[model samples]
Target chain A: MSLASLAPLVDAAAVGDPQEGVPLALYLAVSGGLFLLGLLGVLTRRNPLLLFLAVELLLNSANLALVGFSRYWNVTDGHVFALVVMVVAAAEVVIGLGLVVAVFRQRLALDVDQMSSMKG
Target chain B: MGERIVFTIAAASALSFGTLVVTLKEPFRATVALIGTLLSVAVLFLLLAAPFVAAIQVIVYAGAIVVLFLFVIAYLGERPIVEIGDRLGRYQAFAWLAVIGLAIQGFVVLATTQLPGVRDDPKQVGDIGSPEAIGRSFIDDYIVAFEATSLALLVAAVGAVMLAKRAVKSEGGR
Candidate 1:
């Protein structure tokens, strides 16, 4: 495409204002990057606590995307769903930490691969 | 332009603090970083025009959840961590490669889209994400799901108690 046709796309990236709100794709980029970083942590970090923290990151990324879409569409549905996600995340952390405590007590080891009683 | 600057700062902090959450080895340090990321995301929510959600994000996610993490960290205390071989296991190269690929793809999509043009005029659209709107939805459109979340939280609390207690009881039996 000619630069004449692509000017709008370039403008869209820079048209940041409170009244206009942020572009949806920029939020998506942030969310995607956050998700990737969390994925890296989950894959690489064997510590269950750290793994849970990474999972939190992953969930937060999802929330950010949901809110962005909600704003883009000018609706509250995305906000509601984001709240649901927050609740689920809290529950997940609670249960996860409980399991971590239980498992860590059984053995002082921290690496999750070693806790493969059910098999890794 | 003021909003844009704040959004830029919030987004940057969210990403950087998120990186710290993953990279920090100590649980407490990672959790502190996680709070920074969460608050930044909360500011992002405000910029998105969801003030109610932004408040809840801070009160519930940052305040409640991070406190839970802190309590767990305190209860568990610190322990020496042994190095696991290969770090990220056998797929280290593949994982980093995936990260790079996704980054490039996301950047391309973001660069090409005329997304800002699609955004509605906030003044004409009215308050779509106000507390009243969201509260109405929770009761009218999503009552069942909202109730289900409460049930799920209750179940999770009971299950955690049972699971954590079972471990100690089994240890006593031994």
Candidate 2:
């Protein structure tokens, strides 16, 4: 490709602001990083409470992307969806912590790997 | 230039605190890190001009959900954690690979030219997050989904009570 043809691509990158708002990629990159951190936590952490927290991180990252796209499109739809996700996340945490508390009371253990008796 | 500075600061704080939330040894300490992450994200929302979502994020996630998590932790009390073999060490390579892969994907998607630019002057876009706008959209287009969320919350409350009450009842009987 000619250097002249690539000039526009570089210029697009150089454009600090678009009329639409902030660049979509910036938000997506943060969201992806947050999601991966949460993934690592869920994979490596044994604590159920931390696991719930990691899941919360994942949900928050998704919310960030939603709001970003809402701004990108200049619409209210993404905002509403993000709101719904928040509600669902709240509910999920309540049930999750409740289960953890119940299980802890029963066995005084929160080691999820040890909860394998359901295989019976 | 100002926007660039704000974005940089917010993104840095959000990512660092998010990492801390995952990697911190103490769950309570991790929860504090989570608050930092949420607050930074709220700032990003403000930058995006969605003040309403920003406020909701602060009030709901930072204010309510996090407090709920702390209450549970306090009630449960801290216990000595068993050393699960060094899973992080074993998975460290894979984690790095996955993160790099996600970054590349995001870059390619973002680089695509298919995005439609803002429909109107970005600054001229008025109160998309205002209650009037949100309520109008919520009722006109998303009424069913909105109602579903309320129902889900109701179910969650009852289910939580049921689970906790059952545990208490069993203990009392014993």
**TM-score versus the correct structure, for each prediction:** 0.88, 0.85
**In model 2 chain B, where is the ten-residue run with the lowest total lDDT?**
B115-124
> What would the per-residue lDDT of candidate 2 be over residues B46-159, giving only the tens digit for each residue?
888788889999999999999999998888876554455543367667767876787666556555535554222333456677767878989999999999999999999999
lDDT computed for candidate 2? 0.81
Question: How accurate locally, in lDDT, is each candidate?
Answer: 0.83, 0.81
Q: Taking the candidates in order, what DockQ does each have?
A: 0.54, 0.45
Q: Each candidate's interface RMSD, rounded to one decimal? A: 3.3, 4.3
Q: For candidate 1, lDDT tens digit of each residue in B67-108?
A: 999998898785555565644477667878877887777666
Worst 10 residues of 1 chain A by lDDT: A1-10
Which tens-of-lDDT digit does each residue in A9-96 have in candidate 1?
A: 3465475523545556667878998998998888778888999999999999999999888877778899999999999999999899
Task: Name the runs in model 1 displaced over 4 angstroms.
Answer: A1-20, B79-88, B113-124
Question: Highest DockQ, which number?
Answer: 1
Best by lDDT: 1
